[model samples]
Every structure is written in C-alpha cells, then in structure tokens.
Target: MQIQKINLGAEPSGIGGDSARTSNGKVNTNFDAVVAEFADVRASIPSVTSDLGQSTTIAISQKLFTDTLMSQFNDIGVQGALGFGTGITNKLPTGMSQMQGTAIKGHENWGNYQYSDGSVMVYVPRFYYRWGHVNSPNYAKYGVNALDVKSIYDFVDVVAANAAGYALHRAFYDDGQIKDGFFVDKYQCSNNAGKASSIKNGIPLSSSSANAPFSGLTGAPANTLAGAIDAAKTRGSAFFATTIFIQRALSLLSMAHAQAATSSAACAWYDATGVNNFPKGNNNNALRDVNDTAVLYEGTGYLTAGKTGSAQPFAKTTHNGQYSGVADLNGNMWEVALGLTQTAGSFYVLRTSAKASALTSGATLATDAWGTAAMTASYDSLGASYGELTGVVRNFAIGSTTNQVFSTANSGLAWSASCAGIPQLGGAGGTNAYGNDRFYDNRIEHLCPIVGGNWSYGAYAGVWAVHCYFSRTNGDHHFGVRAALYSV
Candidate 1:
C-alpha cells in the first residue's frame, strides 16, 4: 500500500515530509523549508568577581548602580558565558578541548556530557531539548530552557523592577546542537532571565574585589567590601563581605528548603571540585548541572559591634564563629546580631534586628519595633505583607488536633477570625507565638510575641552550611577551601 501524504504545514509527523509532485511537472525540490536540527553547548564554570566599599551603607547608597559596578557584574557574565562556551583554558583532560563544551554539537544532552569524576563543567544540558520535539506543544512552552543565562545581555528587565529577576540567576540556551544554536536558542530565568539579551549590556563582577570595602558601595560595584575577604575569612566573616545579591542569596537559601519539602532532594553543596579562578565558583553562567551537587549562595551584611544578644542575629543566633561576616545557610547560618545593648528583657541574638536596614526610617532598634526599624523580606499569612494592610491585634485559637492541622501555609497556629490578614501574627510569644493570636510555622521569627524575652532560634535552626570552595582534584567531592562563609 502507498504511504499516506504528510502535511509539511501545521502538523509535521516527526518525519521530514511526504513526497509531493512539483506543479512544474518536475520532482519537488522545496525540501529546504524544514529547520535543520542542531545543538549548543558550553562550559558552566569560570567566574569574575565583584566588590563594593566598606563604610556606613548610608554614605554611598547613590552609587549602587554606578558604571563601575555595572561593568563588574557584566564581566561576570562575560566570563561565565564565554568561558563556558568553550571551557576553561589549560584545564581539560588530554582528549578534551582546552575550552570544553559538548562532544556532539547537535545530539541531545551533548553539552550535558559529564566528566568521569562526576564533576560537571558544561553550560547546560540536553534535558531542556529532551522535553520537547522541534514543533511540539511542549517545545513552545519550555523553549526558554535553552537560553544562556551567563550572557551579559540576558538579564536586564528584572534588575529594574521585577522581583523575580532576583530569582533568575538560573538560565538556559539552545544553539541547535542539542537544540538550536545561532541566536535561534531558547531560554528562561526567575521571570526575566533572558529579558535584556537584545539591548542592555550587563554590569560585571570584576569590580567587586576592590569596591566591596567602600561606604555606600552597593549594587555590583562595592570595592572596599571585596577587599575584606582575606581579613574576614574565618567562619561567616567571608559571607558578610562577599556581597551576594539579596535576591540571589535568599533564593539560594530557600532553594534547598523548597526542594526538600517539594521533591525530597537534600541540598548538595557545590564542592567546587576541579573548579578554580571562578568568582563564587560560577563564572556567571546559569548553565550548570551541579550533578548531584548544590551551591552555597553568597551574601553580605554589616553588623554593629555592641550587639551580643537577640538584637543582632538575622537568624536570631550567631553561627560559624561569625557574628559579623558572610552567611552560608546550608550549614552554619545562625541568627546574628549587632548594636546589642544588654537592655532589660533583651537576649539579643537575632541578626535581622540589628544588621538589617530598618524597614522604616528614624533608625530605631530592629528589636520590638514592628514596621518601624527591623528589616526583613516580609510576607504574612495568605502570602501577603503587613504593610499592604493595617489593623489592630486580636486573639488566636488552635483548632482541635487533626494531624496537628498543620498546613505549611497555616502551620500549627490557628488564628481567631479577628486576626489580621497575616495568618501568622507576631508580637510577644514563645516559639510559635508571635502576637495575641498569630504564630510562625517555626517561630524564631514572626511579629507575634505573646510574652517578653525575644527567644531567637525558637525552632528550625542550623540545617546546613554555605561556602565558596575551589576544586583541586577533578573527581573527588572534597572542596578546596578558597573563601567560605555561613549563617543559621
């Protein structure tokens, strides 16, 4: 029986096309209409660093997005994107190219190829391609998975307003090899991962080392802050100075916890195995597998010297031998502190109280001051914010036990209908208690405190440590200590 004619138009049957007669009475030669499949692969390591000054954060707030800082951040992308495009120089094994990418330019998972030791260096994987056929519906949906996140041009819109831009450190690309190359690639990030790839040039990370130490130095260009690394290498000092983007750090800290709850995947610390000279051990490319490994997000904050109790700890306690340094939440992150006067009813250990920029003005103590001084990324019951609403306090009720009635969203705390929209109201309570009737899934935080003595580290404290390590040996998971910092 003769084969059915294929519709090369709307529905392509995976196969190229069906035979067709030429209107010219000759054999048809329009076979060039179909797009040729290809693949794109690159390395995922090799980063450039950045810096800002060390001084009163208030002094240099205006310079946050200065050109110098922008230049530095942009360089991070240059190193990560281009560096991974090939591979680091003088590092690959004998058969491997000096700059390593994928073995097959077009085969699926081509760049997804892993080294024998399990050390992953490729920019992205083929799974992005595996998810969809060239013309399938899934392809159109997840097509952004194939974008190069390390590109200086990839992330711009989020930098301006979109909070998701902060979560978009991850990105992917396709260059026709495994998927599609030649700018025909697809991509995605927190929300704007591939947003500015067309026009905006990114700020690089190269300036961080020097600018990190200056006052008012922020954004991607703090010079003085970067210089503090060597001096503050012990415990979390490095974390305090390493200048991690708030969005990046918070997103990273939450990633493991989120994944653990949703997918049961224990967070794997990036060993930095065989990785060297890369800033934050990432080189800026969003392309990464981490294989079974995860990364410690870098973060920075300033602490006042007087804080010794709950007044200073962001997590409400200090960890990693650091009260004023960087943070690695995966392991040693703890509630930290600063400017802690041993006042009446004060046990000061919470870093959020001191180190945090007061959410409001007037420079009041971060402790006990709700919506006035304490600084934190806020969210309440109903996944909303207190500032969005205003009202008086009310009482709480814990419904009858039914498996503890614990909804991750609701936690064990039940609210009286009089309670504000914030499901977990916080004021003066212990552990889970926040206010007259609100509470936290695990208290250490939450505005509802039913009594005196702000108890830091009420529950869920110190689950893991975070850091930046250098990979010396290729296969071994042993991380070479480069510079590390951790908190709670």
Candidate 2:
C-alpha cells in the first residue's frame, strides 16, 4: 500500500498551526505547495518498491532517499502544527485546558486506588463515552456527555508502558472526541437480539415516564459474554480483545472499596442516603410488575426526576458512586465478565492470571490476540478446577476478606490451576443487602460469576456481591456489561 498523504488542509499543520511557516520566520507557502505536488510521488513509491524489490544498490539508495525526505517533510509539518521545534521543553499545546494543564484528560487524580506496588490505578470517573457519535441528546439528564472521548481496552498494556502509554492502541485516542453513547436498553437481547428492534438507542430520560427509562437494570440485557463485547465493538473502529471486560480480581477489589466506604463497613450495599435498598423487582415499578412475584414490596417511583420514591429500578443508589467514584456499579444488572467456569467437568477461563501489569493489548480480538493465553483451552483436571478456582472464589465472596493481593506470574498465564476465576460482579437480585449469593448451582453450569444483585433480589445487592449461578452460554434480561477507558 502507498503511504497516505498527510492532509494539512487549510491549517498546514493538522496538529494546530494556522498557516505554514519557515525556520526563517517567513510564510512557507512554497513548502506547502511543493509538498502537495510531490504528495503523489511519495504515494506511488509503494507500488514502485514492490515491483523493484530490494535487490539492487540503486533501488535501495532511491528508497532510502525518498523515505528520508518524506520523513523530514512530515517532521516539519508536525513542528509547525505543535508551534515548537525539536528539543524544546515545557511548551503546552494550543487549546489545552489551562486548569488541568496536562494534555491527558482521563487520568484519575482525586478518586483512585493504589496497587500493592504503590502504583496508582486511575478511574475514568466520568460516565462512559463511545466513539463516533455526537453527544447523547439526553446529556442534560444523564450528565455523561463530553466533547472528547477516551477509552482503554487494555489496562494492563497501559500500565506496562507507563508514561509512554499513549502509544498503546485504544478505542479512543488523545485527539478523539466523544460520539455515540451506548445506553442500557430497556429490552432484553437474544442471539437474535442483534436484530434492529432489540438494539435500540438508549431510551432518553424524558422519552417515557410511565415505564422505567433505565435500560437493562432489572432484566438481563440480551447476549452472551461474547455478544456483549461484540456490541461494544460496533461503536468504534478499534480492535479490542477480551481485555475490556471486568476481571475476577478487579471485581473483588471494587467490592472491598465499597465495603470500606460505608458506615456499616461490613455491608457492601448502601443507597444514596447510606440506607440499604434492595434491587427492584416486578412489584417495584408499574412497568415491571408482571408474572414474577416474590411478595416483597419494592418500588422506586419516578417522581418526574427519573428516580423512584422507595426503591428505584435501575436508578443508581447514591451509595453506588461513593466507593469506586463510579456510579451504578453495584446493583443493576449482573455484569458478565472475564472469569472461571466449569462445564462437562471441564474448566474454562482466561489462560493467564488476571494481573494488571502482566497483560498486553492485542491488535485484534479473534486472530493472534486471544487464543490460548488470553482465553485458555479447556483442561481435563476437574479436581484442580474445584480446588484452585472454585474454593478461592468462595473465600473471597463469603470470607469477608478485602483486597486480595495480586501477584506477578512468570509463566505469562493470566490464571493458574489453583486460582478460581471470579467471573461476574453485581446483580439485581439477592437475599442479602450486599447481594452475596453464590450457591445458585443451576445457573453456575459453567460456574461463571455474575455480580451485583439484579431487580429480582431485593435487599440483597451490594458491592462485594456475586451470583455465579448462570451458565456462560445462557442469556437473561439480568446480564449486562459496563465500559471503562484506560486513558491512553
């Protein structure tokens, strides 16, 4: 393929320059004109090089000379765009925010947690933003709209690169702007849920008050784990592997954070007012009050403000945002995540241990990125699976432990035989206020963990909760996914 011409249209420097200029401080109209004329020459070299190969000395010299010249031209363009020369320091780009000063937007400074190694793990804090769509029309009510969008599909890859992390591939780059916002659909998704009807834009707040406007809060948002990821991919051009999903370890860490932030300390479920409200079920809302009945009183009335009076269906409890600095994390839908499972007496999980530092971002999800190591092949050892995977999961959930330390593995395995993969976190239904129920053996066919109690389980939803009762292949109205950005 030919090297694409750098379009310095109007502004000779795409980065920021108003007009082209020379080192001598003269208007560099000549340079721009020359570059434009020879742009086709640079573009055509790809075909020429392919025909000639690299055998002859003359051909090699020509290729190098042309490449160097083009590089110099691009460098000049970048320098002009940036309004600075090479080796200059402390110069801020034009249009940068004076308050933050730093060009980086998504780095979580105020609300963040520290890792064992003393490195800080930043949260995007702001609500999720998808690429390519203009701000949601419901920006006034949702308060999630932004002029720019930032997404990090791979957190491990970002931390590994550290300061130079910007080079890592992300769904949204530094210059990217917020486009379409993915909303939780009020309807459930099936394999056929990929159809047009099921995939409706998120219902805006003012769209319908008679029914709960929040999507996928009670019922599972249709689709398998794989399907959920695919839907996220549709809004962007970036290639994301399984790296975007929440991991078992991260899920537990979030639980601990929530638990610590509460007055009860032991209880992970707390509403906006610090009171524990159960996940809303059919009886809670007029729209959802259908065949299902647990005889429990649950309802969060939408008092013209998009929230309920007693128990809000999908209305984020005030407590959800306190701990993680993220809203609606605890109780809503059971989030499908990357975790462990057992089916036909075989264990399936991500092959490598889920440590933030040991991972790398892949170019594509299906091809070379996520085969054996990213997602492991099913193993024969049911004994190892039960002992290592299942037991650890149980301890983390019921043992009242906080902050399970993550270790660096040498084998590059995301998970070990002794480790039970914590799959999903937070749901809509459960018996406890914190929604800690992992004994649903029927749903745990593959033993995948679903967290944050759903609508069906009132008073049982909390931060350190799990519902590992569903099969990975199964899709319910309670299953949904949350999106995060790595800030690269």
lDDT of each: 0.19, 0.29
Per-candidate TM-score against the hidden true structure? 0.22, 0.38
Supply the global lDDT for candidate 1.
0.19
Residue-wise lDDT of candidate 2 within 317-339, one digit each (tens)? 32222222233333434554433
Question: Which stretches of candidate 2 lie above 4 Å from their native place?
Answer: 1-225, 237-255, 258-320, 353-384, 387-397, 400-435, 439-449, 485-487
lDDT of 1 by residue, 29-58 (tens): 121111111001112111111122222222
Q: Please report the candidate that would top lDDT against the real structure.
A: 2
Best by TM-score: 2
lDDT of 1 at 311: 18
